[model samples]
Target: MTGLRVLITNITLAGRTGTEIVVRDLALGLARAGDRPMVYAPRSGPIADALRRAGIPVVNDIAAVPATPDVIHGHHVIQTAVALARYPQVPAVFVCHDREAWHDTPPRLPGVRAWATVSDSFRTRVAADTGLAPEAVQLVLNGVDTDRFQPGPALPPRPRRALAFAKNQGHLDGIRTACARRDISLDVVGAAVGRIVDAPEALLPAYDLVFASALTAIESLACLRAVVVCDGRGLAGMADLPTYEALRHGNFGVGTFTGPVTAGAVGAAIDRYDPVMAVAVGQRLRAEAGLTAWTDRWRAVYAGILASPAGPEDSEARNLALAVHLQTWDPAVAPSSWTAERASLIRTLARLGSGLEPLDPGVSVAATDGDRLALTGFHTPEAWGVWSAQPTCSLRFRPATAFGPGRIRLRLAPFLPAGSPDARLTVTLNGQPLGELSFPGADGAEPRDVWFAVDALDGVTDAWLGFHSTPCRSPVSLGLSADGRRLGFSLIEVAIEPD
Candidate 1:
């Protein structure tokens, strides 16, 4: 299938994470199979650079994508939305690489001819969550480049070196302690290690053992290293034949590991390492998870989608627009509520202007649904912060009762290092300035309140809080810190007093 244009979209291709690595390798595979694959992302990083060097086309903006492609493959919700909106005619495929809850109910977009997940478990879960038939969702297991990760002359075992490579730092200390106690020299890699290596997989032959999960675990096994599946959650023990089978169905136990990741537990897993088993694991992975076989599966998938009927150009457009709007629009303040007709969505967007605004004074429109406010931005359970270079987040609230003239105050703290002068922020409410905010020039401090007074709130019931802050000086260059996160501030709470 020469000149089959395959457009792969992702949030970004700047890091060496599992998803990024997969996207890069898939593009390479497509190119090798006589297909033209162009990667579309909003941001670029080392991975993007590497793909370009491999002769794959990479565009940072969807608008810049040349002509219409045969198929659009998106890796995230935002990417799917962009594909649906920008290329309604193209058949689309959504790839579920992570186990995020948000992905379960993906953007109800049009032209999504099929869906693919990295594991069988997700294939079932995603099919149920997205309302697709079980057969509609395909299991596209992650693959490794055997040419680069193949077994080599095993390094000497005198020093007992184990490479700890992971983006998640949750169980890092426990793994480190375990390696220290066992007299194993642990060479940690990945972004969480405060540095990012270009091709860490190629270095796997230098180690006797590797602590990783998902693609990394598979790669290590392919590289003839004793593998342990551990990440932020905990440990999934050593990967023997039984565990390997179990891990395969769970994407190498990416989010399925349920055990505690203690030093002793990790040490025990390390103790089970046998050089003979490592060699066998490598051979098995080479035969099963090699790039050629993986690429053939993708090729078949692409061919199937292309051969199918032309998808409805307007299919799921309304639902997708609604999902995208609710993430940022404050219905209490917008022209229309959630139940408003689709005709009203266009009018509401014009009234809201994609900016947070406080509701106007009118008949007391007490919200019966909920009184809590919803915040929009990237946040993990462990910490909350803006994870964008130029971070701007909007807070939507629905008061239980009609709001009278009152004051709105916000409590927020910077998630920056001590003495970061660049943490200054400008606050706004519906485009109205609420003055600048400055946090304590230190980390680990309680958030302070900043108040905004309104002239009239006679019947105001819904409000929005907007924040803007400085962008990261070097988003792509933040290596070893392994976090390409562009953070602004961590919001604590919001208080509205009816006067």
Candidate 2:
């Protein structure tokens, strides 16, 4: 397979997300294995920069590729379609990473010689979706760069420090509570927590145990850290010698997460941690899940496809598949030429189709109000409130009665970790600045009644309330608590009252 030109396509190279990381490792590994590998992504960012620094060419435009590739290693469906359409003669092996994601749907194209999935779950999904034989979908489990994630210092008798490494921050409160009960210091790093570690290989060594799923769990095991197969979906318990093969077959992903995430569940997972057993698991992973071996598997797939290529589909069939792929197009990832008007129209149509209704006036609504009140930039609601996960959060609703001068009251609590500054919020109504509200650092978690006068509501039937707060900081960074979520403030309740 040496000297084969491989064109790898992905949706974005913006961040170290799951698929992006896979593409990054695959390209680097293929290049090191003597293949001429180039990457094509719709958008470029840090991951793209890293690939370029490693001497692998990355292009956003399909036309920019210097020459046609011998084989196409396609990822997301949209970008894969672009590559396949551009290089009609090239045979492609499409890899499906997610079972539920629209973009991960296997392409029904004739030029696609093969299909690969990262787990047994995804393999089953791809096979079912494409109506192919189960054996036809290859299972290509994700691999870690074992050299980069070498075993760290010996673990203590018990885990003194732990990490919750997942992009989906589901049921984190339970994990935090579990870690607190055991007196184990916990930190979090993931997109949901506003912390994206570019080199998790460097970060995994510091923790004796890691609460993660999929690739992160594998990487942590390679670092000799006891791993609990858990993520936003749920808890999957500890990955020890006995369960490693089963978990590995499922890619240590959602399929393994059979139990709900709770303090008891997480605590039980922690109880299963064994330092000696953890090192044994790491040794096994290093032997079997190395990037080099993984790359070789892919090379074999490409070679096999090249040896017996599938015939190209008829023009009508190809056009129908392309049309189906276009249905999954997201304006957020689309080119700058995607007009705002078009995006707005799509959203409007979606909302209308969804049958969304406005919140009732004079009724105080809480964070758990769900779809009754439109909320954005807020995390999943807890029993008491919801944390604003971003720098700004907003609420949209239609006034039940005719508009008049009024005041909006918000019961909120600032997320002031120890030694951090107080949170200041700039309020906005219908896109116009209303006023500001400041909460002292001492008022942590204690809901305070903050009211702001809004005269602009006089003529508005629909109202948009925005809260722009200071930058949110994670408690792990401040050494205040084990919670890794970057929080600005918590919204407990909101109401609008006539002046």
Best by lDDT: 2
lDDT of each: 0.67, 0.77
Segments of candidate 2 deviating more than 4 angstroms: 312-499
lDDT of 1 by residue, 142-257 (tens): 88888878685764543388888767576687799998998998888877768677876668888888888888888888887888888754567788876676677677754445
Model 2, 362-386: lDDT tens digits are: 3344533544455555555556767
Between which residue pairs do clashes occur in model 2? none
Total colliding residue pairs, candidate 2: 0
